[model samples]
Target chain A: MFPFRVPGAAPIRPHGRAADEVGRLRRPFAVVVYLQSRDPAHVKAVERRTMDKPTHLIEFETMLLGRHLQLSAPRLRRNNQSLDRSAYTLLSRIRMEGPMSIGQLSEAFGLDASTLNRQTAAMLRAGLVERIPDPEGGIARKFRITEEGGRGLDAERSANISGLEKVMAAWEPEEVAAFAAYLKRLNTDIENLDGRPWPRP
Target chain B: MFPFRVPGAAPIRPHGRAADEVGRLRRPFAVVVYLQSRDPAHVKAVERRTMDKPTHLIEFETMLLGRHLQLSAPRLRRNNQSLDRSAYTLLSRIRMEGPMSIGQLSEAFGLDASTLNRQTAAMLRAGLVERIPDPEGGIARKFRITEEGGRGLDAERSANISGLEKVMAAWEPEEVAAFAAYLKRLNTDIENLDGRPWPRP
Candidate 1:
């Protein structure tokens, strides 16, 4: 997002090293950075070698990825990305699953009703979703996507893709597709375990 | 997470089809839910078919992944995972990079100094990290992970992996490794593009 550069930073080590070094570091290395400042200072970080399983690596990477995506929103916002995180998520959900009541949303997302209420309230204010009588004649009122929501979702999703494209600019198309497929599988599996499966497009 | 089941939810479709169907739907399908409650009510939703590239799919999946990770903290917390989100994140970063000043953390994370200060203050209060003099004689003081912080990060990370293991219990080991590798690659690419490359083992 930012074209930040440390004047004297070391090149990044290639991958496969960490993944390949699984079970290689029973007593993980303790990093001691030589934090410097001003005149071409490099915030040196040690290469962490963990005696962790591949799943551990996945967990750690996802944690960092979550942070990246959170920080990524403001960067994209300047590029005219309108949808906030919740809106993108809810709109995407509604797009995939059609109309949903608070109960169904709660069940699908594993989120409490109050949280969904707050999110949907904001979405309502934004005109992203409209209250509709449950099409199947259920007691709980359902939320259906308005044209604005769909349009906003489409735009925001497109912007996100554009941003990702830039991030993955150097990656092979096959690699990109494979990574995307893996992520989808990973999430679907998590959803399955949570009993809150997100509908796929 | 909740093992929530609607009395009548539809079966999941196998993957590969969506990834293969790129650019197939210019105007995505409009989902219609058959939301019913009580007596075997099915929250039936139509499948969405988007005219998007593979990059778009990645974007959508990653957004969902962010949600999964956020929601995952609570599930893991119940399993004796003690570190809160910020604590776990900060400790992990500290562990990986060793000690870091607020200025260094701000530069690496793209977060403001105020946010870093607040996070460090919380870490200090929680006994997770401590302020230490800059090793390289830099002006700004750095925060180092405490023994408690390291121990907590390890435990929390272990729990996270265990949770992921349960989530991916059915997948083969090779698949797990490939997913992890892809995830690392994706994050590194993001970090590289953002000019804040995370140090790997």
Candidate 2:
């Protein structure tokens, strides 16, 4: 049902060999487009190349796309973007997996302890999460999602999921099920590689 | 070939209406999944819906997907999401037809001149663009894309186009051509409405 169009502007001309080499960097769009192009074998070849050079994916994402996407950070932070996602992720984890130690949360996300502390500090400030004295008293505090956090997470979840379902109304039940299954696996695979335990909801 | 595999994890308990509603909010992973699943027609709908609810899209993106993307304001000042697609129109105009004043840029984008001025100010600092002396000696300055900016733009274009090319490799050529055509129309429509003359080059 998608109506495709050619981009009207002039294609960026590759200036030389450097451009050609740099242009081959892995992009998420390339994966999607190749799937649409219906050349799974070519995609398999490209995927093999991508797997062989993990650094290209890292470099392309970090050096280029990451740079451009991130340029908006300061302006975005002053708005709600900074506040919501972390808050939601923290709360989601808490809701799904009971109370967690600050260290546990830190390890789960592979974030520095200090960064986790700082992030949780905000949650504590908002009363979206609470810091409790550890009975073990080992210099670590236990954190739990609060009712406020639950309420906020619920609202956010409701809004986001509703939109997706409406958009997917045209899809067959089997298609939706398949996509959802893939999504969960992808999420799990990503987390597993990062060494995070699966959430137990 | 996407090696389709069944998830080892438990079936994701459908959150019923609540989860679907919440999915509409456009978090990064969710957006990737949602947008990726969509056909070009569906994408146009999503983009239209996103633009129609500009405040929502801005809030949704700013709060949800934008942060994890970890994009900085300065970085975004250089480039916004290609996912938005329409954003490319302004950049395209600047590259093809600029050396235009802030007022002109604002007029072309149909945004508040002050907002466009703010955007250009960041571009100026990043040296992605520059402000030249207005030959007419007005208080306003004329802006043009810098060489570095052009390089950055080209890099992003290559990333996105190449990325899509890979993703849809499994689709037929006609399917690929169709979506490309729609994208071209959408880009042109935005530029035409936004007040920039189409660039010959």
Candidate 3:
């Protein structure tokens, strides 16, 4: 017995049956089938089957990552630095790559120019980054990480690292390496899909 | 030359200098040291060294996960479902586990009661879930997923899974399974750290 009715699992057979009648009849049946099954063993078996599917595994990973972000966002800030995840990431990127134009940052992050403009403008107001002449003498100015921004980024990064370290302390080094490689490959694929692949540093 | 400055790489030496002077002097030195090294070969070496350390690997994974969520949140919604990541997750949980109380959800999610209340209330107003008498005849009422909720959850889940599948398409089945297992383990460890492990289905 399936624990939950798989949505749209039933084919609507219109053979000698009115389409409207099929729709009307199947709706209540679907709901009933979905609500009636509450057996734990069935749920477990269904969950196990779902977990075995690659698509389900991917969905579960996405959901887990989103949940972890929501759960940890509040605790991620350090020393009154209210940098959201995006801000923290932007600062870290700028700090590592030195000054970069908004276009460059946009391309690197796979975000649009308008989004980067708003984010960088906010960062500028917060003194996280400063607009400066492009080091390569380009037409557009570049944004450079400020000292305060570096400190905030470092503090937050360290705090997050410490938290992750504690969580992963039991894992072997090889396990960590394999996970990281997979994650990097995943992100790279995501970036490629968005057509804004970040260049290898 | 490091692709990123390994934050907190400087050894804390309080041997002979005034602590304040050392603090003031080391600040610039650290920044300069971090920025001036731009040799690609050196960067690769440093990256390899960093990857070998489990703490750094964990930090990289955390940062990548955070970045991925920030990037994907906008695309995860379906039509006007308008459910944030947390709401979608909550609805999915209810749909899977049948009716559950706010307290139970809070405990399972490792979130506070007030947060779950606000989330569930929004879900209730949105008709994604309804308050129901506990099936087990407990004092606390439970939340049940509405038919509409299940539909929305299915839509969003399918969209996310499609995206993930595209990302993982080139990966072997075994690779996907290994990555999924690792991710599950990591999430389990994180939940355990918070002392609110979700019961396995």
Candidate 4:
């Protein structure tokens, strides 16, 4: 679905969970479609439409992930770098799926083998992850989250929750709950679109 | 607040009015409390905690502004590149106060004149805004929204609405109304934080 390929990046694998969520959302399931005649203008149009419509924004953010770094900006400025979705996806997977092989990571993210190599290279340089020889095979490699990565993830999670807390400081509990429910659904839809199974239906 | 910057092009600005609308939904109010701590990690930690909450994701997107391709990954691609929140602040001013002078933009965004010059230079190069020689004071330049800038704003608005629509596709009219009301209040709170006068309040 992505037009340009990041040489060393992997596509995030959706699995059945995401698929199920998307299915529930698109009940009678219309075939997924894209605008065929695409140019900078068309892409811009799509972006405009996505931003204007809340539903569209949710879908686009969940799928394309527009603002993953909003919470982490200040901290990231030390290095003057922000983690994009590709790397974030890897972090999320490692956090969610535990340790896995390079091949598995590649499949999960739909990234080419080489892309994973480059991404992993960066992650390794950052000490976010570590590589160990594969137990299954001598030549193959397996990656596991490092202590630093775990700490970073936890920090990110805490920051995320804290950020939410401040934003809703004046919000009623009911309002927060309603929005949370919507967020939950949005997350589910994103997972489904990524080919993961939905929680419901 | 980010652990690492995304290495690559800057985040894409929202394509049009839709993007502007989306930006509204993406955040709520935040108190810009100055930090006494000069430590980068400490500042980032505080910033992340204050901005990373799940509910605040929308707001974080705009504030962090990685989604618009203005600050996040785009700035980090090249080493030694620095990003200040001034341009984004200027964009916010334009959105809140409508068109004004570079001086006005500078004051509203809390930026120095030289900084605005540098920012406007980059902005003009990107074609997101235009330099219209100020009519009131011909000696000064008044930056105005270009057609491309308008389109970008529209794109953001559309993307935002699209996200909401996805969530609301199954909701009843009343549910939509309820959500809209809540959203309106939320927007008001955010505007208050930004010191902008709200129409309803």
Quote each prediction's TM-score. 0.70, 0.44, 0.66, 0.48
Q: Is the docking of candidate 2 incorrect, acceptable, medium or high quality?
A: incorrect
Q: Which regions of candidate 1 fall more than 4 Å away from where they truly are?
A: A1-53, A73-80, B1-53, B76-82, B135-137
lDDT per residue (tens digit) for residues B106-146 in model 4: 55544468877888888778676777777666677788767
Instruction: Write model 1 residue lDDT over A1-201, tens digit each, in one string.
Output: 112323564323233334223223222221112111212223222233222335777887888888888775456334664777877888888888899999998887788999999999999999999999999999989999999998898888777878887777777655767888888888888777677777776
What DockQ does each listed candidate score? 0.29, 0.07, 0.25, 0.07
lDDT of 1 at A188: 83
Put down candidate 2 lDDT per residue, A58-166, tens digits, no spaces: 2222222222223322221223323355676677777777678888877766567888888888899988888777656667778978888888777765554444343
Clashes of 1: 0
Identify the runs in model 2 with alpha carbons over 4 angstroms from their true place.
A1-83, A135-137, A197-200, B1-68, B71-123, B132-144, B152-201
Interface RMSD of 3: 7.6
Better of 1 and 4 by lDDT: 1
Please list, in the order the candidates appear, how each scores on TM-score for chain B only. Answer: 0.71, 0.50, 0.66, 0.44
Residue range B1-201, candidate 3, lDDT tens digits: 322334656422222333233233223434334334556565445434433335665566567666766665345334544456777888877777789998889777877899889989998998889999999999999999999888878887776776677667788656887888888898788777766655444
iRMS of every model, one decimal? 4.1, 11.2, 7.6, 9.4
Residue-level lDDT tens digits of model 2 in B3-24: 2222442212132323233244
Report the C-alpha lDDT of model 4 over A1-201, residue by residue, as the tens digit: 334333454423122223333322321212122123235565445434322323332322322122123322333223333454455557767767766777887666544689889988898899988888876665777778888887776665555455445545787544665655544444444344445422221
Cα lDDT tens digits, model 3, A1-201, are 333345646522222333343333233434343234456565344334333335577567657766776575454334444567788888878887889998888778767999999999999999888999988889999999999999889887777776676778788666877887888888777767666554443
Could you tell which candidate, 1 or 2, scores higher by lDDT?
A: 1
